[model samples]
Target: MEFGLWEKYYIEILDDFGFSREGDEESAKLLDEILSTEGCLTLNDLGEIVGFSDKYIVFGAGPSIKEHISMLKENYDLKDYVLVAADGATTAMIEQKIVPDIVATDLDGNIDDILLANLRGANIVIHAHGDNIERIASLTSFFNNVLGTTQAQPIGTLYNFGGFTDGDRAIFLAVALGASEITLAGMDFGDIVTKYSRPNISNALEEADDFKKKKLRYAEKFTNWVAENENVEIINLKE
Candidate 1:
């Protein structure tokens, strides 16, 4: 979608969902800073990192992630592939000593590990939102000064949860990074796993069910968007 259209859609969705659009604005600013930073990697740089011009693997924190890590490791080499980890997956990946090429997070839940990864020479890509603009700005400064420059500079992707689903930023950023093939793992958008903890609400299970349904719907929309806008391929590891 065009930038203007996307922005309008995002505002409408936020109003409908009772979510604040401030976070989206903050995300946009963060992205702007990253893109304008000196010696920083831009979307074009990301495209080159993955080779093939564009291809990526998005790792979600769903229970199914554990099952496919080995398969992904055995089948795909990380030499020139972008690995986008969602939220808390950074911790799990760290435990396995599997450093993601790029980590995406919204400064929620256990953000320290991401900082640690940056210290250890891992490229971090923080997600920015309007509500957390100050925090995101702080992080950008910290990385720029403390992390020390390397061949691979850390990045920040601004996300406006405007008209998109919760995790759609992960998919969109992966594509923006020039991923021609985007594979998904640990995206339990169907709630097919029984061993996982659902987010807490008055009706947690019911909420999870609804969240799963919405995720699936978003995934379908994402697939269609990719097919029409870019020649990117969407592969669902759950199937």
Candidate 2:
């Protein structure tokens, strides 16, 4: 999709989900600065990566993720595809010792883990927003001079949470990365399972419901936009 049209839909989605346009604008500006300074490419860069992959998987730190991990390990070929990890899942990925091909996060939680991953030579995709622009910018030098040579490239993306606690930035990052058939795992937008140890477990169900409602609405709008612009297929990993 054209960046301009996608930006419009992004604004509309945020508005529908109770986000402020002013905040989004600020976030966009910060993202632009981060991308420009980091020498990152657009979704076009993702196209080059995607063209080489047969399939792609997006890993969310949802409760159900624990259950699917074993299956994913056995069924999927790790080398041929890209594994995109959301912010919260970085620690979990470490616990499970799953080396993600790429990591996306806003640095809200699990900073230690992110740092650890970078230290271990894992390619990290830092998430950025206006609120955290200064912090993200501060890390630019470290990521560029120190961590850049470790992985393929450190990336950053514009985040639009859609005002839903469950609307993970990882989803958009995966799409922007040009996944041909993006399968989501641990995207349970309902109750949190007892098996999961995330802090939001108590309110998982309520949060998931709210997130699902907003996600459904956004998907409908995003689907229409995609139909008119690009030929990308979006699928729920749980399904």
Candidate 3:
């Protein structure tokens, strides 16, 4: 998607969530300065990978990720599709012995699992936002095949494809990069939170706080819009 078009939705996201655009910009600058894009995967490279498959499967860090993965294992050849894990969902995929083709994270998930995926050749897309500046600074060095992105305004090596949370962003990326057909697995937008929701890889399932639910609502709504508006064929496994 073009930045000109994406900015309109981004403005609304800032207004609805009351997020600070300046803070996001600051984080973006820091990330851009630190990330060495030399010899790394470019947007073109990503396109080749995403477009390699007939379908793209984007997985969210919802509670049902394991079951959905199992269903895929039982009925289909995963090698035929490009698999994307959003943030903490990387843990679920890794646990299932499935290494995602790509991972979109904001340093807010299980860093351990994401790193493992990176080591296993998953292209890592790191997003810069206000809340994760410190986390980004501390952990940026641990990743390989890194690409930077910012929702506010992309600078230098960073680029913005669109969408809010990691899950929706992964879909946006798949569409923008090359995938024409997509599938969403374990993308439940309920009011439940679990160990798989965020960085707490050692915890149990729990109720989502109001703020987390609010964000999920945005992700769900935006994802639905993409399915309807974008030219790609998006099949929501939940439906």
Candidate 4:
């Protein structure tokens, strides 16, 4: 998506979360410099990998991810579609021995699982934001290859795929890559947050705090907007 088009939502997100636009820009600059070093995948490289696939399934961290994938596995041949996992959803997919083609994360999820997937040949789509500057510094060095992105602005090799939460952002990435058909899985946007969504919770379900719920709502809204504006077909497994 164009920076001009995505700017409004970026500003709204900043206001909603009381986040810093300058801080986001700084983080993006950090990530851009890091990814521009030498061997990291450029935006074109990411597009090349994702561009070949016509259909995509983006897995969110909602509770039903495992079950949904399991059911799909039994009925359909998943090789036809590109698989993208959103942050902590990597754990669920890894546990099921399903290595996704791409994993989009802000580095807040289980680092070990994310690295393990990277080692096992998954392309990491790493995002930079206000809070994760140190994370982008310390952790990005471990990855062999990464597709860097930012919500703020495009700088160097960084891109603005145009969504907020990891789940919606993954969808945006797919859209940017020319996916004609996109399927949503384990993307419940309701009030209850699962352990997979929250990352390593002892309890199965937890009540989402106001901010968390609001983010989910925005995720849903953005997906809908993209579906309409981009004219991509949406297969909502949630419904």
Candidate 5:
């Protein structure tokens, strides 16, 4: 996507959440710091992996994940498709001994689980954004095979395949890398919070406020946009 178009949408997203654009700048600086310390992989490397797996199953950290945990645990010949886990979903997949092929995260979820997945050889698509600067610093050192991403403008080596949240970003990444079919799992955009959500996030949700609801609204919007925009078939398993 063009940076101009991306900028327009990004600004709208910030407006929707009532956040400042300066936060993204702070996050990008932290990503620069991380690049100075650890070597980074380009989308080209990510593309090579996606080329082999034409089909994908994207897992999101939502209540439906717990509801369908049994089916996911069954395996059912999932090796044939690429497994993409969105942020916090890594922990749930790891606990099941199912390491995803790709983990699209912004380091806001479980940093330890993400680091562990990276150590285990999963391609980590580390997203840099305003809210995750400190978290990125804490976790970037532990990753070996890492790809850099940004929601803002792409600079130097960092690229933007396009999507706002990790869940939609996973779909966008797959679409960018040439997936013919993508299936969604655990991506419930509803009112209830998932049991596996980050403690801080869960606590916020306990209030039953619109904050969490609005975030899910953006997530749903981004994913829906990807489904409509991409040429591939995106099946929402939740439905």
Candidate 6:
């Protein structure tokens, strides 16, 4: 995505949600400050891992995921597809013994489970932003394989592949890696709040539900943009 479009979306997010962009920049700076002993994983490296499968299943932390997990397990064979989970959904998937091939997170949800998944050989794509810079420093070294990301700008090791939240970013990642087909599960953009959402993680956001819903709306918009612009086929499992 072009920097101009990124700037456009940044302003849109701010206007729509009534938040400051300063935090996002601060988070990126913090991520830059926190050095990792392990070398950075480039987009080429991620592409190599993702290019193995043309089909992909991206799991969001929406409550509907709980409803579909049994059906997905019994009816759908996931062996032919690459499985990706957004942050908190990692724990939900792991609880059912389904380990994702990639976990896209801002470290706002459950870091321990994501770390466990990393230990279990799942690729971790950690997003750096203002709210969770401290979390990044505390957990970055524990994972053997990690890809850095930032919403502000790509500085040094941190890259911007586009998309704001983890769910939408997961879709952007699939597109970036050249997946031919991308299927979504638990990506509900409704008013119902899921337990995995960061609103439950922190009390800093005063209007949590409004904030979460707005983010979800933007996520849907961003992912839809990826679908419209790219050749990739995206299907909502709920549909």
Candidates ranked by TM-score: 4, 3, 5, 6, 1, 2
What would you estimate as the lDDT of candidate 3?
0.86
lDDT of 6: 0.81
After superposition, the stretches of candidate 4 with alpha carbons farther than 4 Å from their true spots are none
Model 3, 174-231: lDDT tens digits are 8877677888988998887768775553566677888899889989987988888888
**Please, what is the whole-model Cα lDDT of each candidate in the order they appear?**
0.57, 0.53, 0.86, 0.88, 0.79, 0.81
In angstroms, the error of model 3 at 154 is 1.4
Judged by lDDT, which candidate is best?
Answer: 4
Residue 205 deviation, candidate 2, in Å? 8.8
The window of 10 residues in a row where model 2 has the poorest summed lDDT is 145-154
Candidate 4: tens digits of C-alpha lDDT, residues 43-162: 678777766578999999886787888987888688888899999899888888988889999998878988999998889999999999999999998987799999997888888879
Better of 1 and 3 by lDDT: 3
Of candidates 6 and 1, the better by lDDT: 6
Error of 5 at 118 (Å): 1.4
* Native-to-model Cα distance after best TM-score fit, residue 122 in candidate 3, in Å: 0.6
Model 2 has a clash total of: 2
Task: Pick the TM-score winner.
Answer: 4
Q: Give the alpha carbon lDDT tens digit for every residue of 28-129 in model 1.
A: 556556546633554555555545535677777666777777788788785556777765666666767787766666555356776766676556555555
Query: Against the correct fold, how does model 4 do in TM-score?
Result: 0.96
Q: Rate residue 75 of model 1 by lDDT.
A: 86
Clashing pairs in 4: none
Clashes of 1: 10
User: Could you report the Cα RMSD, in angstroms, for every candidate shown?
Assistant: 6.2, 6.2, 1.7, 1.3, 2.3, 3.1
The clash numbers for all candidates, in the given order, read 10, 2, 0, 0, 0, 2
Determine which window of 10 residues in candidate 5 has minimal summed lDDT: 199-208
Comparison by TM-score, 1 against 4, better one: 4
